[model samples]
Target: MSDEDEGPLVKKSRIFYGSLEEKERERLSRETAGTGKLKDGVKAGIAAGNINISSGESMDLEERVSERQSEVLAEFERRRRARQITVSTDDAEVKACLRALGEPIIIFGEGPAERRERLRNILSVVGPDALKKSKKDDDKSKRSQEERQETWYHEGPNTLKEARLWLAKYSLPRAMKRLEAARAHKEIPESTRTVKQQELHKNLRNLNNFCSQIGDDRPISFCQFSPNSKMLVTASWSGLCKLWSIPDCTLVRTLRGHSTNVGAISFHPQATLSLEDSDVNMVSCAVDGSVKLWSMDSDEPVADIEGHSARVARVTWHPSGRFLGTTCYDDSWRLWDLEAQEEILHQEGHSKGVHDLHFHPDGSLAGTGGLDSFGRIWDLRTGRCVMFLEGHLKEIYSINFSPNGFNVATGSGDNTVKVWDLRRRRCIYTIPAHQNLVSSVCFQPTDGHFLVSGAYDNTAKVWTHPGWSPLKTLAGHEGKVMGVDMSPDGQLIATCSYDRTFKLWMSE
Candidate 1:
């Protein structure tokens, strides 16, 4: 073409090197000895688009090309939505979905094929339930196999039925009262709530080292604040269970029950407050494979409930104050009838040692966590498995139920605190809580506003929930913090540390 027709700025293209027999441009353009020739249409398209083509070819070029073609087809199929999934052509579900998508359900002179294709495209954008149904249908066989393998079959003693009914009867009234109290609490004036919350925050921030006493010769493993928050009960590796007056550090009583290290200790919900001192006011479990009941006035155990063949790791009181749930290294947790003084249920489900357990605030459900890196929630009334908490990557060490009735908190050796929602049936929040394993966790008693977690990192931390934000860190321990508890009165924080002492906290 003439320069005048080509554009005023046109210039001659440059060559790669001095012109020779085998020029770079010539070698690139001409076919070499043996190579896969491009298809005529591909060559035409490449020339039309001014695409670059290299001279050499791979030895496995055909295999690679086939693989690439298959991948392209698979991706196309994955993205395609030409056919709709509908159980019935005239079903109202499909019609409702179509209407919601603002699509025409029927077109003039359209057969079922066209209508279905239109619905498919529309549902791809709007998310029809039938799409889920179709995916589930494809997975139905795999799911059935899993269901068959996951069948949990266990039969307790014949008295299990009576125990379940009794639990139902005892827990129903408490559950009702708790719900009513929660409703009333929510209905309170915003001003009243603010004032109460401010008071609590002030008290919590004022929590400081009140007193530290050497109650045990060995490291303390567990510590609990009484229901009245007037005293503290601490168990140690020396096999001693000691009760000391709060703030004063005065030893009130020493109950020498276990011959080995005490692993768990808990007071009855009514202990030292309403129940008589002669009643079985406290329970403790030890590494000696025995659980013992104690009274306020006795230096010896009031009763011995012996059935475990391995170490008893944890003891938890039911909200009804009539049942006790204990975890053992025997790969099981058992429920004890405190009134009848007998073992009511011997439940075994964990693959490894059961380490910790807690009853739901309403007492109708119980949760257990263990060395298996998972936790299970059980229906107390029917003994059926309710939910599985499976996100912890290491052994679960502590569990606590929130007063709100739907949330559970678990501390694990993975150094994380996970909060689960029973209603959502999933882990709702995971707090990267400690540098080492988390050892214990507890939620505030009445309002369930805050959770306290202790860890082997030599720290105890408080976290506020719903958002799960760290509130404060209590870092005075000289060694690993083993146990933590929040008082029902919201006035005390107790922690047992491997430093061989239990510290008390109060505002200023």
Candidate 2:
């Protein structure tokens, strides 16, 4: 082919590497060219100007077509970007914007979509700066809307005010004492702390699943160790919660109360140690929307706390043992006054069902995780959300505050565990800790020296502090591990599984 017929060098270069389809079709055509009759037809067609095969003139025509296609694509891309310029889609909003720009709000018979598009084009031509005034107005309206939704005042009984006052008074000293203890903990030499951590790590590495007991006929939904660590309670989908003596795994008592799947159970902070046996020693909530408080001496509930409109996923006792926090599937969490046997605070913040919550050792704050993939920390005294725990890519299933009072660990359906530093107000570490959705997380009740996570992977993992290193993986469950808890002394770990059994792990 002649250089003049080859078109401009730039256009020729664009087609030098022919399209993949053209190359494949050419290869196919060459492979089928064995018959002379086919070649004769092709020759005749080419002479009649019906077919042209890679000739210089055809190349020029192809370049021109390609240039036209390039222009069209560039124009389309420019319009797409312009269309993406921010403009409210509401018809009234579009008309208002047009009015603000001194343009006609309507055209002959233009519908909503067309009117919106016309406004978008105008805004694109004038640029985003033109919307500054309307944007400010919109921002003001949005802020008002958010404020209304962020804080809702629910009038409780007249006792609620007194309860708040009591709580404010009750939490201060505990917070002070906790801060003092944290300071003393920090005063310990790093060398000593390191040695202690190493010992803990060694013990965790030595952990072995020693006993597995079928605690229920159905899947166990939750489990917790009593404050004294001598007893463990497992709640099951069979609607019963069973109390067992730890180490021996012997059934102590079966609390028959919930009429449906028992979703959560909690032992009072002072249960079996200082709290009276005849008082409220344990609290359990079920999918029947009932919360029951039981005494250690009775096989029946001592008090039936009601008010939840949906399933309660988790219940936790305040360190003071005066208040109870329950998370529900209704996207709300409530604080119950045990003395009054009434809900004192009905707080709504989560956009999805609240899955789990834990109280800080000081009892001044509560951290809750939800199916919305977010966790929020509420200041108990002021009833305000002070910190937002974000970063998980899927629903957060469990959350627990560290003994240090400033660190929080959350396990999520994203198959990861995140540690948030409240002092820094951000997520500090993300541990890809499981092969399946994480169902529960717990910190060592004494010093937060280690963390435990249970997951649908049929395994429970032990992680040591300082570096968040994996120390051991307890892998004996035949089904998904639904819950995990560490003994108060950190000497033992208990896990409940969907296999209808609960297992005990201890240093061997």
Candidate 3:
């Protein structure tokens, strides 16, 4: 072949010039001082280390770098696609995939899927970390969405709204009165207060010794000191109410008519002090569903309040001593007129048997607790439920309206005593007061600051209000303490237990 027609690789000098377009070759030749020998110019420049490559060479270098980057990106995408699976992939299948990827089929004591996840994580670490982070974010978002969907809300009844409003109205003034009284008590000279307390404590210490008398054949359900603190009224599960003289502990009279266990007994607010012994001095409720009123001298009940269909659990005389309130296993609490011998109102709000009842010191409101773990305060004048005591998770066996009027204490089967503030409409305090069900709670009638509670845990506890601190824990009972009562003078605490014994704890 002719040299002029030789291939580009063979005729290097000519091909170098031939590869350039005519204008580009001219520009190169001009730049190289009109030397048309492109190959010689390149050789000389290389020897001098000043070779000036054209812009086309720079463009080729960039293209090669981009191609390498694209190849790396394509490999990464392939690995990602291999790691991913559709929702149809089973856990067993995932384990198989991990095994095929040279990972453990299972970890120590872990199932196949977890092992597969561990293997997948090992592989992901070899790749970009962003992929794993994105996967975690996606999982968290899905879990959060599921939790939100599972949440629910329920609508309460209109009666609950009305009850809330009533509580606001009924408790506000009562709360104000209590706060005022507390402020007044705070103004008493500290030295004088200390002296009074010391004297009270001396009196309490003097009552350190005790004597026991067999008052009944069966267990005593309750025992209360009269308002005058001179007489003791003891009710037994054998359905007998016996009046005894205090200090001496001598039986004075036996009032008997109930054929079943007597569950509760309470004296008239003025009984034995202002009221004559010949008048109706006490009331007792029994399992036979009868509430009987008795005079101090009578062997038979002076009057019978007989409207309940099931067992009567507790009876209370209103603070005014004119009306009677009784709780029954019939799931109702009724208010009775003592002189009229008639039921004036039958309150049916609790879903379970009413266990205990108490009237507020003002005689305007009453609180009832039941086996349903709920208690309600009813405004007697308006015949409306003022507030609901709603935090207990087990049966409430006893409830007491604090003499302060706005605070109510409830003892529950959950072994807790919760103090509810009617004014704040919330539970203000909870005392894990016992190891078993708390059966009864009573605020000191005169102090309005201290409380007494008895429990199936075989103990009675004295609690102070405002902060609801436990002041004392009495642990002498051999069996469950079923009832507790505070003297009107706040000097003595009486408790009855399932062990068929009555105890007097004097707290000056």
TM-scores, all models, native as reference: 0.70, 0.73, 0.63
- Best of the two (2, 3) by lDDT: 2
lDDT by residue (424-483, candidate 3, tens digit) is 989989988888989888887876666778999898887655566666777787888888
Best by lDDT: 2
- What lDDT is reached at residue 404 by model 3? 67
The numbered model that scores best in TM-score is 2
In terms of lDDT, the poorest run of 10 residues in model 3 is 149-158
Please give the ranking of all candidate structures by lDDT, highest first, separated by commas: 2, 1, 3
Model 1 stretches astray by more than 4 angstroms: 1-151, 189-199
Can you list the residue pairs that collide in candidate 3? none
**Segments of candidate 2 deviating more than 4 angstroms:** 1-149, 153-157
Q: Which lDDT tens digits does candidate 1 get at residues 12-129?
A: 3112122432353364335321234654545676678665556554245557656755765554443343333443566466555555555666679977666666676656545567
Tens digits of lDDT, candidate 2, 177-270: 8888878988999999888877878878889988899999999989998988899999999999999998899999999988899999999989
Candidate 2: worst 10 consecutive residues by lDDT? 56-65
Name the regions of candidate 3 deviating beyond 4 angstroms. Answer: 1-183, 189-209
